[model samples]
Target: MSKTDFPRRENFCEFILIRSVGNDSYLGNIWSDEAKFTKNGLFKRHNSHYWSNTNPHVFRERNFQESWQFNVYCAIRTDRVVALEFYQENSNSKL
Candidate 1:
């Protein structure tokens, strides 16, 4: 989908924590950095992909992660995640 499709919101942040569940031999643990809400109100960045080693086919086959901790700025509305703009904390140049 085009980036524009994801509308940016304001003053929001979300932190997601992902972990492995069982001996599925496919999944892995992951810990994402705090997802800041950009002007569009969507998550900015996602860090840590635990299952990077597995094949795409196998990775998609099973559900393996145990739990997720989402430290969101506001209450989650629906399944739809608000869009946001991503920017570095420290930048020398202007946009």
Candidate 2:
């Protein structure tokens, strides 16, 4: 946000954290707790099966693995959420 977007001279922007386990969900505060986070993976093209011209591969089960994505995005502010905890089984797909 720019300086002109500020509504007042002093403002407080609170951070929010949320988690979901399939149908169930949970919401909590991230500022008060000393939260630790794992670094996100690098951005690059990912291919499970390699392409080859000289070799012929046999077909097996097409479903190699189940892939799920997760991300944590904070607003543009000084007091922002720096870290987060993400459980594989129960993770929030969106903010």
TM-score of each: 0.17, 0.18
Name the runs in model 1 displaced over 4 angstroms: 1-23, 43-95
lDDT of 1 at 57: 50
Q: In model 2, which residue pairs have backbone atoms overlapping below 3 Å?
A: none
Angstrom error of the Cα, residue 65, model 2: value is: 0.7
Estimate the lDDT of model 2: 0.37
Off by over 4 Å in 2: 1-40, 44-64, 80-95
lDDT scores of the candidates, listed in order: 0.36, 0.37
Instruction: Give per-residue CA lDDT, model 1, range 1-95, as digits (tens).
Output: 46754453211221121222344432332322335543433444444244556565543232346422233332222343343334545223452
- The deviation in Å at residue 2 for candidate 2 is 32
